[model samples]
Target: MSELKAKLFQDLSDAVVDMDEEKTVETSHRVIDEGIDAYEAIEKGLAHGMDRVGELFDQEEYFIPEVLICSDAMYAGVEVLKPHLKGDEQGEKKKVVIGVIEGDTHDIGKNLVKIMLETSGFDVFDLGRDIPPQQFVDKAKEVGAHIIGLSTLMTTTMDGMREVVRILEETNLREQFKVIVGGGPISQSFADKIGADGYAANAADAVRLARKLVS
Candidate 1:
């Protein structure tokens, strides 16, 4: 039985990493047929595969397109398992606030981070793009979020992240949340300049940093 379970998990992980939607769906069904726990399949299979994909991304082995497709497969598997995840299981979620900073309309990076964070067990409050600094602060305060992920594809919008930090500092909320910055033009140096708690090169790194930040 352990071997069978391992095989199913391996198949599911491979399907997600391969970005094979049909294969992922089939494997999800196979796990169900085998009476395997859906949460185990998600945690041990798709989530594990996504972590590898993130590493590949960090190493420059995988690019944005590949990450997108792989995340799609993982989300598909999650959709299948969503129905079976228990109420108690659902309530243990950690909240994360995410959005693209002001003057930025690009959502590709933000969406990727959102998917990766959600897959890693964060309940993300996505504020969408073109969001002002105050909006981010408001949402984070309202949701009692521990992590605030800011995405910006334009250099022009990088200042928005700084503004967010400034606003938080003024309100005694600076220590209330960890600020994580990302997007096309952001770097660890930039994060340091702006006083951000963390910076990730891609979605997976964002999840890693966010987890550490929240913890």
Candidate 2:
């Protein structure tokens, strides 16, 4: 990329890392004005910044509030760029219903996954944190979703994931939707035990797993 383009992308990334919503909006407008590809701006700029934010959270350099603000900045940038995206970039996308399991108010991880899924062209229905297991299945059914994404950072709430699976099986909807689980306390064995289709380690991995399950 040209120097000017590179600098603008860097600015977009930095705005998110700094949690500067105004600057993120301004830089995103600059990206559109400068005729840069909106998709690249999202991937290389906003998403890149969120990746850093995720790392910070992992290292405890950034807490829940900071990460949430950072995501707001990134999302502000994304909104500015969304309308400018090419039609082909938004081809038919599989619908996914995602939310944190019951009793867990922590949604930083869920937010990250939503951003990644939305950016990757998946139709994501985010139910926010502290969601009940039945709600996930209900939303998936309501939206004709192909996937149900369950998340929780707490072990106590992990049972909610299994509960969702059980509910789906009881309702005879288990075969209709692929279930994917992830979070700090979730493991491949837990996912297997719950009869979920897959387990993702992070947002990017969730996107990949969603694609593979749908494919």
Candidate 3:
């Protein structure tokens, strides 16, 4: 990468972390003006910042309000770059149904996955926080979604992920959709225990996992 490109990407990342929406918007325009790849900016800059925000959140250095504001800044940058995406970036993409499991009000992880997946050409249906396990199945089936993503930051709500898988098995829809699980309290072992197809550690991995599952 060119030095200018690296610097701009860093600025975009910092803008999001700083919760500076105006700065993100300004940097996004500079990205377009300099012909930096929009997708690259979203991935390396905006998403990267969100990754940092997630870490801070895990450490309790940043709370829900801070994360939401950072997301706003990230979205502000994406809004400017979205329109300039190359034609190949536009397509009839796979569908994903995503939400935080029941008893868990934390939705930041789910939100980041939503943003990243949508930017990567997936049609994402965000069901928001504290969604019942059955609701995830219902929405996924309704949308003909190829993947179901379940998230929760609380250990108490982790069982909801297993319940979703169990429901799919009981309804004989287990084969119809790939179920992916992740959150602060979730791990690969937990995902396997719940019969989830995969576990993604972050937004970028979620996008990669979604692509591989659908492909």
TM-scores of all predicted structures: 0.89, 0.73, 0.66
Per-residue CA lDDT of model 3 for 150-207, tens digit only, reads 9988899898999999999999999999999999989999988888999998776887
Which is the winner by TM-score between candidate 1 and candidate 3? 1
TM-score quality measure for candidate 3 = 0.66
Q: For candidate 2, lDDT tens digit of each residue in 177-203?
A: 999999998999999998999999887
In terms of TM-score, the best-performing candidate is 1
Candidate 3 residue pairs in backbone clash:
none
lDDT of each: 0.87, 0.87, 0.87
Better of 2 and 3 by TM-score: 2
Which residue pairs of candidate 2 clash? none
Residue 68, candidate 3: C-alpha displacement in angstroms: 1.2
Runs of candidate 1 with Cα error greater than 4 angstroms are 103-105
| Inter-residue clash pairs, candidate 1 | none
lDDT of 1 at 154: 84
| lDDT assessment of candidate 2 | 0.87
Worst 10 residues of 1 by lDDT: 100-109
